[model samples]
Target chain A: MKVVCIGAGNVATHLSQALYKAGFVITQIVSRTEENAKALALSVDADWTTNPDNIEDADIYIYSVSDSALGEMIHRNPRKNGLHVHTAGSMSLSLFEGYKERGGVLYPLQTFSKGKAVNFKDIPLFIEASNADDLNVLRELASGISNKVYEASSAQRQQLHLAAVFACNFTNHLFAIAESILHEADIPFEVLRPLIQETIDKTATLSPREGQTGPAVRKDFNVMNKHLDKLTDHPEWQEIYRLLSQDIINNHRG
Target chain B: MKVVCIGAGNVATHLSQALYKAGFVITQIVSRTEENAKALALSVDADWTTNPDNIEDADIYIYSVSDSALGEMIHRNPRKNGLHVHTAGSMSLSLFEGYKERGGVLYPLQTFSKGKAVNFKDIPLFIEASNADDLNVLRELASGISNKVYEASSAQRQQLHLAAVFACNFTNHLFAIAESILHEADIPFEVLRPLIQETIDKTATLSPREGQTGPAVRKDFNVMNKHLDKLTDHPEWQEIYRLLSQDIINNHRG
Candidate 1:
């Protein structure tokens, strides 16, 4: 089936490439900039377009644009007969109203970094469609690309996305904080690699609650105060240490 | 070398087993209970003891007990000639004062769980010996069991431990929070596994700051507030969501 991908950012780049690799005909690549569109279009052996008027006949048009731009992107779409699917976690299927009768979502519940290689087969695909026929089409396409696919309503997907913000995005920020602390102390960040690996590995067998250790889980205030005092120079980090440690304490023991 | 483990908790269990496996003769396993001590003692083919008066002479006495109980455990140790070391991250070498003349610290900076096998060679071993001779002994022993061994000052190791709380302990709590969020929504926790793995994997090559992504890094407060609103049923979680995302925004663009 012919697929046209709109937007050429990280999600768009990864999703378009994966779809093309899975034998979907990437008929065109669309982006606001000619350069961005052409870069992705050339990679997928498809035509490039900057004008919304240049959009062509395709089985699906993936609006992989940002959440802020979804409305404008949908407003400019010229295709009236194709499946208008989005790759947003928080957007409702109703966004495609008056744009297309066959509206759906094919949100890949994973972070995508452009120019980085990612195997889409195991990345859980959360999909939603406005109609039965559109849902079937999405299920087939998603199944071909991924082993794990679930049809979630917009509400559930929004919650999942919020959870990802905690699980993925905030976790990465905490790592960044740890990196800064290690860098300031002239300690090699690599020293913590094994511990970090084990931290995640334990979650496979034990629940995160069961895997918790160190001062916060044990509610050792001495260690918590020491950690806070060490971060006194960075007051923001100190607050974070206090707040998160307190949360853990209250959640576990309270 | 002859050794005695003074506790049978997670760290004590793993460290004692690893030392025994590395050909150290575990002379005794000492705990408050004969049953608990004997369990570990049998695993290493060592004598078990609840009474500190029964402690035999060993080259090293490892105090792997809890932080709160370290003082009491130290007071109970009858040995006066051995090299006394601790396997605690946040503790100082001064804790060994008056307990042993040859004292030090042999902190294995990793989370240990009972019944789980972990490779000692990969786990970072942080050592802080009280003297030159004990330092050399710790260096030799730590190097024998672990490839990643570092002779760190108490201050440096404390900072490392603090950073670890952020990276390992707090990150696991975030996962627990995520699990709860997903649970309430009836979403499967496995959906976030690939994302979690990639978040850590990227940190291996990219600095965690460079690896940061999502609305927080983008300074997209619209979505951040949306997430907070979705978490209305969970006030504590909402606060965490707000605080972490705000910290990310402040750190990146500040």
Candidate 2:
């Protein structure tokens, strides 16, 4: 299989490497910047081009650009032959509306950062296409790198993206908030490392509901009230505590 | 050093077993119920007793009881000489006020669950004491179990605990929300396992501010508004999404 990765960011960087490692020929690498495109292309032994016109026709075109810029990318590329796929969670695969019939989603369900090594085998791939043949092709492509792949629809992927906000993005925000609090108190955040790892590890064996602990789950009004009182000055933290505690209470009740 | 562990709950169970494994002589395991005491005592090859009076004087008396019942525990087990400590984050070492000479905090900064094998060496221990000598003794005891020991004050520990509620407890709630949303969509939550792991793995390499990726962080108001609109009925999820996005935005602005 041949692929033309249409961005030089984290997702593109990692996915291109994984595909290339899996023996898929990356025919070309395109990015807004010549340096980034050249760097990744050199690494993967593919042709590098900053101009969209230089993008070659291939079996697959992965538009792994920023979500906001995806529509603009589609407009610029204007490819009508091969399959055009976007590696975005929230963006609809239909973004490539005027393109070829092979347009679909090749979304790798993991948070990727530039230069960080990602084990594609452990990451899940959500594959969706317009037809059965395209779907099977995408599935084969996804299955080459990952053990877990699902034929999720655009609506389902959108809902999954909304949940991803809560699961991955928002959860990290919570960690940042906690880090900020500890920073202000002149406390090292390292003390909470074990607790964080254990909390994540518990989900491996038991459901988060069953493993839930703390004042909210225990319904210790005294501790809850104490924590609320402390967060009075920080309304954001207070709002978070209230909303999450209410969720915990509602979860337990149900 | 000789140690007497009070309460046979998760912390007590794991702590006693670890101490025994580390070649420390655990003289006794005390609990409100004989069965609970015996269960942990047998693991450590120590004697068990339900009565507080049966707690023989050791080099250290570690109370691993729930926060609410701490005061009564201290009152019941009056120690004349050895360093007495409690493993609670919010609670102060002053809870052992009557025994001013040898009172401290030996907080194992981790969430412990019964039936889970916890490697004590990996868990950080936050220690605090009323006096210098007692601090050293408590520090020594802590060092035996974990290389990561910090002499944190009562105020520092309280802040750390509050931070933990956001980092660990509330983060788990986010996972619960994700699980619920996936369940509603008839999508297997296991598909998100890799993404979840990557979310955590990203933190190890970069500051969460540096690692932040999503529609919210990018201020892609279109996707954000779409998600909010989708979550109109699920007010709880909407509130979380709003609050966390705002926090992320505020943090990233610098």
Top lDDT prediction, candidate number: 1
Clashing pairs in 1: none
DockQ-derived CAPRI band for the predicted complex in model 2 = medium
Q: lDDT tens string, model 1, B1-254?
A: 88888998889888888888888889999999778898999999999899888888999898999888998888888879878888888888898787668888988889887766888889889899867888999998888788888889898888899989999999999999999889888997778999999988887678888778999888777788888888888888887787888888787775
Model 2: how far is A25 from its true place, Å?
2.2
Which ten contiguous residues of candidate 2 chain B have the minimum total lDDT?
Answer: B93-102
Give the poorly placed runs of model 2, Cα more than 4 Å off.
B53-55
The TM-scores, chain A only, for the candidates as listed are 0.97, 0.94
The reply for model 1, stretches above 4 Å from the true place, is none
Superposing all C-alpha atoms, what RMSD in Å does each candidate have to the true structure?
A: 1.3, 2.3
The positional error of residue B22 in candidate 1, measured at the CA in angstroms, is 1.6
DockQ metric for all predictions: 0.82, 0.67
Local lDDT at B73 for model 2: 82
Q: Say which candidate scores most in DockQ.
A: 1
lDDT of 1 by residue, A1-254 (tens): 89989998999999888888888889999999888999999989999899888888899999988889888988888778878999898888888887677889998999877556888998999999977888999999999889989989999999899889889998999888888888887997778889888988898888888888889878788888888888889988887787788888888885
Compose the digit string of candidate 2's lDDT tens values, residues A1-254. Answer: 78999999888999999999998999999999989999999999999888888778888898888887888887788567888889888888777776556688988888888878889898888889888898998989998888888888888888898888888989888888887888988876666777888888888877887778787887877778878887788888898898899889889995
Q: Write the per-residue lDDT of candidate 2 for residues B45-110, one digit (tens) a residue.
A: 888889887679888888888888878888888566788888887888778776535789977777
> Cα lDDT for residue B239, model 1?
78
